[model samples]
Target chain A: MTATDTHRTIEAIFRIERARLIARLVRMVRDVGLAEELAQDAFLTALSEWPRTGVPANPGAWLTATAKRRAIDLLRRDRMLARKHAEIGRDLSEEDDAGIAAIEAAMDDDVGDELLGLIFTACHPILSPDARVALTLRLIGGLTTDEIARAYLTSEATIAQRIVRAKKTLGKAGLSFEVPRGRERQERLSSVLEAVYLIFNEGYAATSGANLTRPALCAEAQRLGRILAGLAPDEPEVFGLLSLMEIQASRLAARIGPDGMPIPLTEQNRARWDRLLIRRGLSALERAEALGGADGPYALQAALAACHARANRVEATDWRRIAGLYDALRRVMPSPVVDLNRAVAHCMAFGPDAGLALLEELERNDDLRNYALLPAARGDFLLRAGCSAEAKLQFERAAALSRNEQERAFLLGRAKACSV
Target chain B: MRVMVFVKATEDSEAGVMPTTELFEAMGRFNEELIKAGVLLSGDGLKPSSQGKRVAFDGPSRTVIDGPFAETRELVAGYWVWEVKDIAEAVEWVKRCPNPMFGPSEIEIRPFYEMADFGDVVTPEIAEQFDRLREKTPAR
Candidate 1:
């Protein structure tokens, strides 16, 4: 391969192996911060040397070895302290090729699970929820702090500090580098799953950006969810999360038109939906129900998504079942967002008038005041009710409030169509 | 053992966006869990960096960095000092607390030194001063 290809290959390998590499290093050093720094140093070294020597056959192992050597060098440099130096020397001597091979093999064996553990660690409750999400994406998702900040429309400095402080807190607390257990595991797992779902939702329908959907983020979230499902095969929420992402992802191909504009669900070409994703989603949902975890917020959402997945057309969707699921979700996790969604379902199940009443009730709450979806949903209801003038006004308002380019364009199209 | 858990502050966190009702409810559930498990000593959110001041001592000269420090990442948002049996026990407790941020955030934990930990080199006077300082500061 050419030098450029070698560099690209290294980057790809790092993207896939970054979490595992850091996890293994953390295990050895017993310091998350130091482990990450070492991992970064290794990446820098690869950037400088990989091009000249060509990529190694086992790039992940090579990077680990390189990082370990650097760590040993640093330890040796601190040899002025006799006792500390000796400790370092002892560790280095003990970690011969055989030990290194064992560590590498162990890392490769449960990499997915280890990555999930790392995610839970990053999302630990000790950190602020924002820090948890930021750290998880940075460490487990292999995303840069800057990337995460941008994803959330925040400053890079804010994200950088959150990460630094998060690592420091973990270190200071001397938190163990392992997945939590029992009740603690269940709680932390919820946050981990929530973070993953948040990432997927942003990718599925970007809150704000030039593009409507960031397919890469969606794919990554789905990949992580699948890994989580495998690691915790009996956890219903895991399957629920996977089912939701899979079913939502199945519609990606049909959600955009030939010109790259947003396509309303009713307007989407059902033939273009990925049947494989739908199948995976249905299977995951079944697993979740079989595990008796059908009552969770995620599972309930997945069941609602299943209604759409089973439908051949938008009209064929079991809107009443979806409405019932939303009702359950509201009871479990009450929020204006859920009510808005329920309103949409009610419209389909009964009529636009019923949905409009629910929407109006939700509108009284200040939380949805700035939420663009309220007006967008209202506009849809109006359009169906043949109130073209009122619908046009709501659509225009929605178009004005929306930050997403695709969403704005979609709303504007709806407004223009009403005018016609 | 006295362990210090550092809660990294974010811009929103410092702004005193009084945890929303939902956030409080979530945190209350977590705190109840922590208290029930006997891991929580005391904790509270911090004021914005703009309201605080950092004094750096070098030799005899002290440099005071005003609140709203330019570096958000470097600021300490809040902290908790827990009396635990050991680091392992502290970790178990921290694992149960609710995340304080609405988005990605982190809390760091560090061990505090007791007079007994200082061996014979440290005098009682210094220990007294450390105790006084600990008293002046909030539990986090």
Candidate 2:
């Protein structure tokens, strides 16, 4: 075939097979850094030979075979590294073709466990959050450092350094390449989920930027969530997190305005919401519920979002149920943010006066004094309660406190509308 | 199962340039092959991103933003929803298709989550409800 065609094929093959190849290699070598190098070496070999030799029937197997051979050769050549050689030098006596076939055969076995191990290793809590993100995307997401950097809107050098540091930390810590057992496994899983959700939240609402959202980050996080959900199907929280993200993401299309400002839920056009994502989210929520995680923190959040997703219009929303959910969430995972949301839900379910009372209480609290949303919510309630002058002042406060330019502009616009 | 194959937009597509006749004919033949193989469920191309708009959100408020979105890499020029046995089978078919763009392009294949993929979480009642929903709207 043509040169470009061959290149595209090889690239696609590498994207599809890299995770499995590296996972298996990591299993053998017990070093993520070495495993990655071996996997890349295999891809380099394919780039050089596949164009001329034609694509193999099973390219993944071919790549794995090549990587396994290279790994063995590297280990054998390192005469001083007796421990490294001893650790990986297993059944290496077979000659060329037989050896390749044996390694390929081994790759077909226990890929699931190997991949799970790789994921846990990448997301080990010992590494810093930044390092975990970089490593997870590189190893499990099958993304290059450049791709990870581009996705996060950071410099390639920064991401590269983060990854190198992560691998070095993993090596120094001597983390095992196996999914931990029992409670430890759950803890590791939480770390993995946290990293994914943190990435999604940053994309969903950037902490500080001209734009309200970064769609690529949301997409990447969701992609990683899906992969995790598939890997740990029995984990109720995996489904919970996936459901939550899916439903929240459905609103992405309706969350921004023509002026590049943030849009509140009440004003968003329901028709613009992505129905497919809502459906997916609902199905995932159902799965979470069936798996006995309906009250789980993420699942509860999913239910809250579902309350909105199910409504055809803002007026049709089940405000009372949403309020009730907030109450439940408060009991289970009582955070200031949850309490703030609960206050709004109470107002929506009761009246503007009721919400105003809660906001007034929250206002006296020092913890939420700097939170822009607290003021924003208070302003909305006051405006609805016919205290427009007071609402105007609150909106101005929110605008000043907000870091995101789009959000500040939105709040300032609210302030202007209430000025009269 | 069904997979959505997204044809990523090239610079030409983002600029609203139409595919050349040769490329169009080549894609047509490719689609015909898929059709003959009973793999092609549906296919369509999208207009340029310039015609699109984004609605930004902050709680209950929304703001609309007109597009010629800065990120061309995120744009899709076309998509095909194909029924395939699995992702590997889908990849095999994609590998045989002619280039969909004059310049370098990408096709991302994502599987639609089948009810079976959800395992026992999809109870019989839920499965029945899903079946009814599918009957109401067959596209899924």
Candidate 3:
């Protein structure tokens, strides 16, 4: 291969190995920022050396070996004491300083657990949610600060500051590099899953970005979710989150019209939906359910999406089942969004009046006062109830409240049609 | 995107030789790594062409051909369907796989198509829809 080809190949190898390398590095160096820098140093070494070394047969292992060696050298230089090796790993201190740190010989097969530890660390609750998101993408997703900045539509310097602060926070915290057991595991895993899901939603339906959807972000989140599922295969919520993302991402192709208008689920071309993703999602849901997590918040949501996925057409959707799932979901998640979705499901399963009754109850509260969806959904139920004038007023209110240009236009069009 | 990863047939694989227990364990570890990376969608080994059949097609005719076809190196001993960011990612992952054959073997990666790939043939109107899902969550 040409030098350029070799460089690209090395880059690909680094992307795959970076996480595992840093995960292992943090366990030894005991600092997230220092470990990441050491990992980058190893990557630079590969770029300069791999083209001449012709890329090893097992490049991933070679990179890991190199990163560990570099990390040990850095520690030796900083500590100026070989005895500190007990904390770094004593087996390595016994070896000739010149020899590599295959040092943690016992950890050769335990990289998986180390990686899970890294995930938990990056998403630790101590950091702000934004900091956690930034750190996770940096340390685990193998993305540069600039890339994360562009992905989230923030300035590169801001992202850099967030990551630097996050690493310092983690450094001060001196968190253990092991997956917590029992209740702690459950809580930490949720943080990891939440961070991942947040990434997906930002991509799927970005709340702040100029573009409506950032497909790259969704793809990244999905990949993260899938990887998390593999790491913690026994965690039903991991699979549950995976299933939810896959099923939702499958609709991405059919979610928008050619004219840049958002396509609601009922009007999307069913044939356009990605069957492969749907199949992957359904199987993931099955895995989650098989693990007895059918009632988990994410699993319940996945079950709700599955009801629509199984239908070939809008009329064929299992509305009653969806309504029931929403009921169950509301019980666990109990948020304004879930309640609004539950209202829609009730409308779909029963009649317009039933939906209006729920909407009336919701309107009496201040929680959803500025939520455009409340007015939009109420307009739909009113229109179906033959209250066109009232529905038109609601639609106009919804259109005014919406920040999305396309959605605002769509809502206004609905309002205009109400006069007919 | 999705790609088909073909583990080319080798002399031992063509002879219906089974992999040793050590090889099996190594391969299992490699597969587990792929799963953990979320690159593997599906994968399987074929029962050698000796147990398979092929049909050749002509203008309107078809002829059945028996197994153990020639060009052994051209035949696939196993394959994996992987979901990856690009062919580059696929190549890196493939490099990590254990030798599928008892002896030296080659592997190939080829990405397949989605409906969007045939843009001209499909609807030209459906363009850039990937960037148009309205924000569902309020800004944090």
Interface Cα RMSD for candidate 1? 26.1
lDDT, candidate 3, A259-359, per-residue tens: 66568788887667777788889999999999999999999989988888888768888999998998899888988888888899899899898888888
* TM-scores of all candidate predictions against the true structure: 0.59, 0.71, 0.87
Least accurate 10 contiguous residues by lDDT in model 2 chain A = A206-215
Give the Cα-based TM-score of candidate 2 against the true structure: 0.71
Please write out the lDDT profile of model 1 over residues A1-420, one tens digit for every residue.
Answer: 777666666676676557788877776666888889999999999999878887676777788888888866665455436566355546545435555565456445555456556777887778877777777778766778767777766789998998899998998988777878898888888888887887887788753335432555776677668657756778999999989998888788668755666787777766656565687788889899999999988899899888877776666779999888988999999988889989999998889998999999999998678888899999999989999999999999999999999789989999999998
Query: What TM value does chain B of candidate 1 have?
Result: 0.76
* Candidate 2 wrong stretches, greater than 4 Å: A79-108, A206-214, A389-420, B1-90, B93-140
Question: What is each model's TM-score for chain A?
Answer: 0.76, 0.87, 0.89
lDDT of 1 at A350: 87
- CA displacement after TM-score superposition, residue A323 of candidate 2 (Å): 1.1
Query: Quality of candidate 1's docking, in CAPRI categories?
Result: incorrect
Across residues B43-77, which tens digit of lDDT does each residue of candidate 3 receive?
88998889889999998999999999899999999
